[model samples]
Target: MSTTTMKYAVTDSLMMLRRSMLHIARYPSMTLPLIIGPIVFLFLFVYVFGGTLGAGLDGSSGGRADYVNYVTPGILLLTVAGAATATAVSVATDMTQGIVARFRTMSIFRPSLLTGHVLGSVIQTLLSVAVVLGVAVAIGFRPNANPAEWLAAVGILTMLIFAITWVAVIMGLVSDTVETASNLPMLLMLLPFFGSGFVPTDSMPGWLAAIAENQPFTPVMETLRGLLMGTEMGNSPWIAMAWCAGITAAAFAGSVALLNREPGR
Candidate 1:
């Protein structure tokens, strides 16, 4: 793109970012669920079910001494789940209110509007992930990996959040109503249950194991667990990266295609 266009993109993106932050500031209650849902899930899994599950899995080996550590990654994923949904709702609300259409009629760069929303969501996801990490630490969860590995784990989670946000963006762009947009996030949240989030694939039935082993979330969880627990991820890192890339590509292409389609086409 030309320098003028690049400048427009940056400026428009910043404007969008500021507007989103303003919305958050004006209505602080919107952030409550982002904080609460992860904490609730962490407590339920770590305290209520942790002991029995850890004992059954580890037995005398003490292989899984800290059940909190086992579920921390899942909790981080949950944090992203909450943030992603909120982002979808915001974007959809803007679309339905003619905010996006109004902007499109202006001289502003169009893609930057979407970029700003996605960037804001990324920021929110990072903050939520940090809070979840803190909660995990307070509950006695410890990372077995070095600083580099921990960074890698965070990077993986960030990428997953980014990929998922695109899916949310697509929903926001296409949904006819704000209520419909809100449903997209809940649908995305269901992905973890089918993967290695709450339970290990080995503990599941054969058919379920097969599904979990191949699902995108399983590899992402495995990669995070490997980094946190210093265990072999069994090739999950590569699979996870592939899944992220695939989703990112598909979602971006779909969003662009939908945006470009004529209103009645």
Candidate 2:
């Protein structure tokens, strides 16, 4: 917690980050799937089912009821979620390896180890998000935001990814094995569908509609959509940030406590 410790932690985190990135570079298959999975969903939703889904919207779900604009944000959220799953798996694998035990004997910054995996995953997430965004742009899905708006959008996505990283860290630490950690975060990927990612909450049944409107993804998606298309901001930006901050704080605390409770896990 001292300035010296803080300085060392940052240095150690960056070093660990480079190590994680090198792993990804060496394992092209691991890197490819995380980037491709969301791209497939984007194409399928926008092409295969877009017309049918758009017809249901009937032009009431903002001007972006056209499937591409309506669903791009959701796919971006999926990209981050998928990256978080990878993060969890990587962390769990590290826990099982001899390296974690070796590090405990060294004088290196301990938290840096976790930060490395999470930060590395975040860089991957941002890369995947950019690829998705590029694909979205190629297909004529215009967000139409100015530079400032685009920056704001990026800021929100960054915070959201950072929050999800902590959650993945906690999952990785507490998991009994890599398989469990890998599979557990699948729920994060499904959450967008349950919320307002693909469609408007108002269009669903009463019970389903209520759930869709209130979930974390719904507000985040709504905020992103509004910012991109220049719609009403309302309270969505604040609400979305609140969710991100709350999750990040809780998950960071829990992950730290659990890591201390179970060393090398």
Candidate 3:
């Protein structure tokens, strides 16, 4: 990274940031689901099935409170997934429109361009998390932990978003079209269904339970839940960080390799 290269990277990143913000400004409707979807999920699960599921898991007859605490982490993860979709779709659109190619033609730092998009996505993810948390509070989902625990919860969620954004970037670069990028987010959204998001893994069938307990999302959600509820994370925090780091490295390496492989001028 020569000074010139570093400068280019920073400049390119800033350009990408400006472009992303402009797109958001131009289309405010897309922001609606950032608040709506998570709220809906919170209401549907916490009110409808929270009683039965909570009772079965917590040994209480109707444990809506426990259910609320358990699912809050899952909902936050889902919000990050939703934000990642936008990142992927926007990157794919830029690639398809030849914008990336044009940038490549210039002396712009290629890595910076991707980094900028990832950074923008991370910012958006943070905003979405804040919105979800606010909604969670409104719906009686209070964190039992002190300020330190709350800070840790934020750190964990930030790490999760950082990792997921790279995955989204890879999808954007590899997908043949923007529509495909649009669909990639659903994969992240579905992880919770198979894990301990809505229910306890112990109660699941043996084989399925094993998989669910060990899945990345399970640990991530458990880590967040533990931090928020001021309870034992039971090995989830470390496992979640490992998963996030591994995925992020793989995705970043793959995306960079692909981008650098293009024919030279």
Candidate 4:
């Protein structure tokens, strides 16, 4: 792209991002569920099921504190899932509400509309992650990660959020209605449970264990757990980033193509 064009794109994306932030501020209801849902899961698992679940780990004395450490990575991913779902709904709303059609008729950079949503979702998701992490710490979740490890953890999370936000954008693009957009991304929420979110893969039967061990979220969760708790990381960190990069590339291309295909999809 030319320098002039690049500048225009940046300017337009920033304006759209500001619009998204304002919408978030006005409709605080949309963002609250993203924070509250994860917190509820954190509290529910820690207080109600922690003892028994802690005992099921390879080593533990069946304590809530032990489970708090074990379950935190999964809860964090849940926060990301919630944010992605919300992004889909937001994007779909814009698509169906005639705003996208109106934007297309204007002189602004076209891709900036989607760019704003992706960037805004990433920023909002990170904030939600921080809030959930704070609550986790308050409820006895502790991480031994140093400053560098904490930074690395945040880096991976940002990558994951960016990638998934694009995926959500595509979900919104193809959706005919806002309800379908919301429902389509619900699978993202279920991925963690099917992975290593709630229980160890070995704790499952052979077939189910295999599914948990191989899925995308499992490596990401394992990477987070290893970074935080000093567990065995093996190749999980690299594997997780590879998944994020692949997803980001594919989803970014798909979202842009979908937007460019139809004027008001």
Error of 1 at 215 (Å): 1.7
What would the per-residue lDDT of candidate 1 be over residues 109-200, giving only the tens digit for each residue? 87777778888888877887888789788878888789899889888988898898888889988888989988878976776777778777
- How does model 1 score by TM-score? 0.93
Whole-model Cα lDDT of every candidate shown, in order: 0.81, 0.85, 0.83, 0.92
List candidate 3 segments past 4 Å from native.
59-61, 263-265
* Lowest lDDT block of 10, candidate 4: 256-265
Worst 10 residues of 2 by lDDT: 56-65
- Candidate number with greatest lDDT: 4
Candidate 4 Cα deviation (angstroms), residue 131: 0.9
Give the per-residue Cα lDDT of candidate 3 at 100. 83
What ranking emerges by lDDT with the best candidate at the front? 4, 2, 3, 1
TM-scores of all predicted structures: 0.93, 0.94, 0.93, 0.97
Top candidate on TM-score is: 4
For candidate 3, write residues 1-265 as lDDT tens digits. 7998778778888987887777776876666676678779989998998887778766445578777877888888888878878889888988888888888888767787788788878887898789888888887787888889888888888888989999999889887899999998888888887888888788899999998887788998888878887666878899999998998899899889877876441
lDDT of 2: 0.85
